[model samples]
Target: MMLKLRVDNQEIEAREGKTLLQACLDNQIYVPNLCYLEDMESPSASCRMCFVEIEGTPQPVPSCTVQVKNDMVVKTDTPAVRQLQRTALRLLLSVHDVDCKNCHANKKCELQNIAKFLKVGLKPKRLERYLKETLIDETHPFLIHYPNRCVLCGKCVHICRGKHGESVLTFARRGFDTIISTYSATDESSLTCGDCDTCVKACPVGALAVKESS
Candidate 1:
């Protein structure tokens, strides 16, 4: 069933069960987001970048987690929404290594695109930058993981699990210490990732890369 919604004073039609973020995106309305994928059964909403103001809502909400409804009024460029998005992006940048010149993602990085869209600089002015001590993890025989460049969006993990019944890549630790961990050598040898590069391709930040020799 198609539902009609007014976004930024523009009328759009989206499936009833589609998320507000997806709905807006489908209609050519841009909303900054990182942790959302169209195939996700349940959006993590961890990025907190897709905020929008809906009529009757006291505060801005993450559009990725909200279902589209008929006659819904959404404002994607409200002041409150921009404030939340900027703050969330700044927080991500605080811990992110912003050496884009040398990074593989460079001009194509999602973080850079989001920063441009929000008119926020890649560096956080008020927040002090804190990067992980370990720069790269070559534990995986076929892949290289860059901790500092990672946004912890979990797209790689989700894509891995979707491709294989189970994922060899999983999030480890908690809070600021969180990082993606791969399976043990013995376990990884039995998995199909040796022949797969989906996870690397799914990463929006180029944090994961296929080893050249692999």
Candidate 2:
């Protein structure tokens, strides 16, 4: 059933069970997000973007994790929401390579899009810049994994699991050491493309991509 929700005082029709993020997009409202994929068993909320202010809530919440409720009041651009998003984005940029000039993702990149949406600089200023850049893994015949550009969103992991009934990509380590890799980071033979580009296409950032030379 279609239900009406109030977003920034604009009423929009959204189906029940749709995440606030999805509904906002459907209604042409922008909500900055990187880790959100529509069909997934779990909401990673990894990127820490997509915050929206809800009335009566103590603070802004991740719209990707919030289901649309009838008469729900959502403010997507509240000052508190902007503050949280800016902080989260700054941290993401700290470790990222920030080499957009020639990067494949370029204008299509979600990180770039969200950074523009929030009017936040790609370079981390107040946060200490991280110097470690994970080695680029070109093990796969068709795909490349650039850990330096990864935001640990897990979109590739979910897509691989859904399309193949098994996950080739998985999260490794914790904290600053965290990364996305195959069970065998050096095993190119384990990859079975099955004629599907689901993983590469589902990637929000350019962390995963088809080799141009493939």
Candidate 3:
């Protein structure tokens, strides 16, 4: 079934049960997001960048978590929506290492694109920047993890699980110290990440990369 809705004053049709974010993106309406993936059965809504104002809602809601409804009305460019997106971007930047020139993602980084879309600078003016002391984790045989550069969006984990039935990547620690950790491979035969770059490709930031050969 197809549902008709008005977004930014333009009529659009979305399949029933499709997320508002997916619907908008399908219609060429850009809503900044990072944590969302099309294959995800349940949206984490972790990025908090895709907020939209529904006509009857008191406040903006994350579009990735809302299903489209017939006759629904949405405004993506309202002051409240922009403010929420900017604030979320700034929060992500506070813990982010903004050395784009040296980063793997660089020009193609989602954080850079989202910052550009939200008109928020990569550096947070009011928020104190915090970074993990451990810059790199070399535990994984085929991959390197950068804690400072990660946005904790969990796309890599989700993709890894989807590809391999179970994920070798898992989040460890809590709060400001959280980082992606890999399960220790008992032996060469026990490793499952062999030649699999799904997690690396799924990372929106340059947090995961192929390690240089020794």
Could you estimate the TM-score for every candidate? 0.97, 0.93, 0.97
Candidate 1, residues 172-194, lDDT tens digits: the string is 99999999988474455576876
| Of 1 and 2, the candidate ranking higher by TM-score | 1
Candidate 1: RMSD to truth: 1.1
Q: For each candidate in the order shown, give its overall lDDT on alpha carbons.
A: 0.92, 0.85, 0.91
Q: Give model 2's clash tally.
A: 0
> Considering summed lDDT, which 10 consecutive residues are worst modelled in model 2?
183-192
Number of backbone-clashing residue pairs for each candidate, in the order shown: 0, 0, 0
Candidate 2 on 56-150: residue-level lDDT in tens? 89999999998989899889999999999999999999989889986788999998888888999898778887745655888766778888888
Candidate 2 backbone collisions, by pair: none
- Give the per-residue lDDT digits (tens) of candidate 3, residues 1-214: 9999999999999999999999999999999999999978889998899999999999999999999999999999999999999999999999999899999899999999999888889998999999999898887777888999999999998998888888888888899988888858435567787788889999999999987772
For candidate 3, the lDDT comes to 0.91
lDDT of 1: 0.92
Name the TM-score of candidate 2. Answer: 0.93
